[model samples]
Target chain A: MGRIPWRLMFAHFRRNKLRAALTVGSVFMAVLIFGFLRTFIVGMETSLAECSANRIISASRLSLFAHMPKSLEPEITELAEGKAEITAFTWYGGIYIDSDPKHYWGRFGTHPESFKKVYGPDLILEEDAWQKWTDLRQGCIIGSDLANDENLKLGDRVHLTGNIFSGEVDLEVVGIYRSKVRSFDQKTLFFNWDYLNETSKAAGGRKDCVSTYCMLLKNAADSGPLSAKIDAAFENSPHRTMTQTERAFQAQFNSMWGNLPLFFGILGGVVLLACLMVTTNTMMLNARERIQETGVLKTLGFTKGTLLVLTLTESLLLCMFGGLLAMFIVQSVDGEILMFVIASVPPSTIWLGLGIATALGLVSGFFPARLVSRLEIVEALRRRA
Target chain B: MSDNALLRFQGVDKIYKRGDEELHVLAGLDMAVNAGEFLALMGPSGCGKSTILNLAGGLDTPDAGTVTFGGEDIGALSDAGRAGWRSRNVGFIFQAYNLIPVLTARQNVALPLLLTPLGSKARKEQAERALRIVGLGDRMEHYPNQLSGGQEQRVASARALATDPRLLLADEPTGDLDATSAKDILDLLQRLNRENGKTIVMVTHDPAAAERAHRTLKLDKGRLVHSTGAAH
Candidate 1:
C-alpha cells in the first residue's frame, strides 16, 4: 500500500532530457492530429445545430441536379392550412468578374416574398433596400460575407460572367444580409425567380423549373406529417419529390466530402499508432539503462508491482503533459489565419485528447513496465557490472 | 541450529548452468548466524559466498533445504510474501554502491523507509538521521554522481540502516572502493555491528575487510571449511 514518489518519476525524466522531450513531443503530435479530427466532427455538429427544426427542403428524388416544376409550389401552399410558409430557389452559378476564375459563390433565383417570411429576420435588410430588391427586376440581395469580399454595398452593381448559363449578367446589389445559421452558408446571392425564368426562356432554356422548394412550419412538430403529405402530393409525377428536414439535407454533404470525419479518424489512429511505437521504444531504452537502479530498488524492498507502477506513472505523466500542451497550442492557433473553413477544437475534444493520451501511455508503457517488474535482481545488477 | 540464530541455512544447494555444463556452487551447505553478531563470509570466485548471502536476504531460494530468518522459513514464502518479509527483516548493501543516479542522497536513503506506512516527512527525518549517523549529514542533498566513492557507499549504508531492519547483508560492499575508501566503509560496517548491535552477514574477497567482522567463515565451494575469532 505504499504511494509512488512522483518526484522520483520526474527525476528519471528530467535526467534523460532528450528522451523525455521526444516522448512528450511524440504524444503531442499524435494527440494534436486526433484532436483536430475531433474538432472537424465537432464543427460539422455545430453547423448542423444551426438548422431550424421546423424547416424542410423538398428536392428532386433522383438528384439535386434534377429540376422540379414551379407548379408544385402553389400546390404545396394550398395543401397547408395556414400553417406553412413555402419558397423556391433555382441554383445559379455566379463567377465574379475580375476575381480568381477558380473561386465561385452560390447564386440562387428565389421567390422574394416567401423567402423573407421563411428565412426570418436573420436575413436583415434596410426598408429601402428591401423595397428596391422586390420592385426592381434586375435587383439582387447579397450576403454580408459576399458584399465584404467584393467591397460592395447597397445599390452597387456587380458584373458576373456566368459559366453554367452562357451570359454576361449585370445585377444591382439592393441588399446585403447575414444568416444566423452557419449551414445556410452566408456567401450567396439571391434574385427574383420571375427575373430568372423570363431571362432563361429568352435564352431558349427550360422555364417554370427550380432546383428545390423550401418550407417553414409555424409549429415545429408538424414537420414529419407535413413532409409526408408534401412528398405524397408529387410522388406520381415525373418530378417526384424527396422531402427532408433542413438538417438532414445539409448532412448530404458528408457524403459529398466522402465522409471526411471517418477519414480524419483513421488518420488520427495511424498517427497515434506511430507515436505509440516511438514512445514505447524510448521507454524500453530508458528501462534498459536503469536495470541496475531497478535492481537497487528491488533490493531495498520495492515489490515488482511497485516498480511497474513507477514505470507506468512516468509514461502517463509524459503523455498527459503532451496532450494538454497540444490542447493549448490548438486553442491558440485556431481561427487566426484566413482559411476556407474555420474549424474549432471544442472543450470536449480536449478532454477526449487527454483520454486518448492516457490510452497511449498505457499501451506504450506495458512492455517496459513488465520487463522491469520481471527482471531478476542478480541478472540486472550483473548487466551493468 | 541455535535457538537464538537470526539466520540459518540448512542443507542449501545452489547450481549454475553454463552452456549445458552444470557448475555445482553449493552442495548441501549448512550454516547459522547468531543475533547481533557480525559474520563475514570469504571465498574465491564462483564459491557461492554471495549465493549464501542472497539466500539469507531472501533474494534467492535453495534447490534443497530451507533458509530461515527469525525461526520462519523465508524460502518457503511466496515471491510477494518474501519481499514483504525481506523489507521488514533485511537491508542490503552492494559492492557498486548502487544509488539511483537521479535521487539525492537523502532520497536514496529514504527509499527503504518508503516501503513502510510512515509519512513522507517522517521518512525524510529518519533518512536524515541515518545519513547523520554515517557522518554525511551535510551531503544529504548531493546526488550519487556528485558524491565521492566513500560518500556513495555511506549513503548506501544509510539507506540500508534507515528502515532499522534486523539483519544487514553486504555483498563485497568495498570491492569498488580505494584502500582509504574501503577502510572507511569497513569502519562504518564495523561500527554498525558493534555499536548498533545489528546482525550482519557480509560476503567479501578481501581478508582486511573480513577482519573487521567479529568472526570470519572461510568457504570453499559453498562449504564452511574453517572459522576464526568465534565458535562454530
Candidate 2:
C-alpha cells in the first residue's frame, strides 16, 4: 500500500483541460436538471403535507372548473350538523394591467369574513387591515409576495378585468396577508364575493355562484366521515358534490397536469444515464492516454490497487466539483419565480445532488480503473499510440 | 563464476508464441554475476538482451529453471511477493527515459519512495538529493518535455538511483540518446557502479557502450557466445 498520488491525479486534469471541462460540464447540466425535476415532486409532497388536517374541500362532481350554486353552502353546513365551520370561494381569473396582457395571476372571490374565520392564524392579516377590508365593499387582500412583486400597498386602487366576466371591476387593496405556506403565498389575491356578485349583476352578467366550498371540522379525525356525509347530502342534487380532505383536493389538482411529473422523472433518469456514459468515455480516453505512464509507475513500485484508486479519485473529484457548481447555480437563481412554478429546491436537494454525483463517479470510473490496473507492463510500454 | 554470486541464472528458459509459431528467446541459459560487478550484455537484434533484464528484475519469470537473487529463487515467490522483492531490491532504467509526463523531475524521482513508509517531506528531500547527485538539482522542477535528451536521461538515472537498491537493471539505457547524451549516461552508470559499489547488469548493443563496463558478455540466439575479461 502507498499514499494516494493526489497531485499527480489532478495534474492529469491540467494536461487534458478540454476533456475535463466537457465531462464536468455535462455532469453539471444533468444533475441540475435532475434537481429541478426532483424539486417539483418534493414541492407537491410538501404542499400536501402542509394542508390543514381538519379541513375538507367540497367541489362539483364534474371538475373544480364547474360552478355550484352559492345557496348550497347552507345545505352542506346542515349536513355538518353543527360540527364544522364552512366557507366558499370561486376562481376570478383576473388579468393585471391592460398593456401587459401576459401578466396574469390568480384572483379568487370569497366570503371574506368566513374565509378569515376558517383560515385563522394560517393567514396573518393585521387587525387594522382586516377592519378596513370589512368596512369596504370592493376591498381585497393580496399575498405578501404579490404585494411586494407588484409594488402594491394599502389604499392603492386596483382595477382588475375578469377573464370570465364581461366588465372590469374596481377594487381597493386594503390589506396584505402573509401565508405560512410558501406555495399559498405566491398565488393568492382574495376579493369579496358580494362585490363580485353585485358588479356582475350591475353589468348584466351571471351572479351568485362559487366553484368550491371548504369546511373546517371540530376534530381533525372527523374529516373523513364529514366529507362522506356532505357528499351524500348533495348526491341527488342537480350539481352533485364530491367532497374530500384538503390534502386529497390538492392531490387532485396536482393530477390534472397528467403524468408530467412522472415524465420529468423519466427524463431526469435518462439524463443521468447519458451523464454516466459520457463520464465513462472521458475516463477511458484519459486512461488510454496514460498507458505508458501507468507502466512507468508500476515499475517504480506502485501496486495495481494504487493505480486503480488514483484513476477512480480523478473521476470522483471531477464529479464532486460539478455537483457543487450546479447546486450553487440553482440556489443563486430567482427564488420567487421558482416558488411560483411550484418547484421548491430545498437545502436537502443539494445533498441529494452531491450523493447522485458521487454514485455517478463510482459507476463511470469502475471499468476504466480496472482497465488501467490490469495493464501488462511490457505491452503498455510497447504501445506507441 | 563464484558459488556466492549476487545474481544467478540456472538452466533458464523463456518462450513466446505468436499465433502458431513458438519463438525460443532463451533456452537453458546459465550465467552469474558476483557482488559489485558491472556486467554489459551485448548482441545483435532479437538476441534476448532485454528478456534477460526483465527476468532478473522479476518483471517476467522463466518457463523452467530458476532466477535467483540474494540466495532466494524469485521464480518461487508469489506475484505479490515478487513485486515486493522488486521494490525493495531492484531499480530499473529503460531506454525511453520513461518519466510520467505530468510530474516534475522531483516528483518523478520521488515515485519509488512512495512504496516505503517515508513521509512526503522526507521523500521530497531524498529525491532532491538524488537529483543533485545526477547534476540536475536546478532542473528538479522541470517536466520531461521541458528538458533536453541528456537532461531527461539524468532525471531517469536519478529516479533509478533514488531508492538505493541492491541491484540496478538497465535495458538499452542510452538507446534513444544522442552520442554526447549517451556518453554522459554511460559515464554516470559507470560512476554509480564503481564509486557507490552498486551491482549493475546493463543490456546494450553498442560496442562503445560495452567498453565502459568492467565485463562484457555477448549473446547470440539465446546463449552466451563470447566474453571479455572481467574485473570481478
Largest TM-score belongs to which candidate? 2
Q: Considering summed lDDT, which 10 consecutive residues are worst modelled in model 1 chain A?
A: A333-342
* Residue B216 lDDT, candidate 1, scale 0-100: 93
List residue ranges in candidate 1 displaced over 4 A. Answer: A45-115, A121-182, A185-252, A324-352, B1-3, B18-20
RMSD vs true structure, all candidates: 6.1, 3.5
lDDT of 1 by residue, A252-314 (tens): 745567777778878888898999999888888888989988887887778899899999988
State the C-alpha lDDT per candidate: 0.83, 0.85
Q: Per-candidate TM vs. native?
A: 0.75, 0.88
Q: Report clashes for each candidate as comma-separated counts.
A: 0, 0
Candidate 1 residue A210 Cα shift, in angstroms, is 11
Q: Please report, as a value between 0 and 1, the fraction of native contacts recovered by candidate 1.
A: 0.64
Candidate 2 structure quality by residue, lDDT tens digits, A1-385: 6666778887888988998999999999998898877777777777778888888989999888998999998898888897888899888776778646335667888887888778755888899888778778899898877787788888888898766754677889999988776446454688888888778777877688898998888899898888888788878889899999888998898887778677988899999999999999989888888898888777777778888999998989899888888877766542344533555678888889999899889888898899988997777877854
- In the order shown, the candidates' DockQ scores are 0.50, 0.53
Could you say which candidate leads in DockQ? 2
Give me the overall lDDT of model 1: 0.83
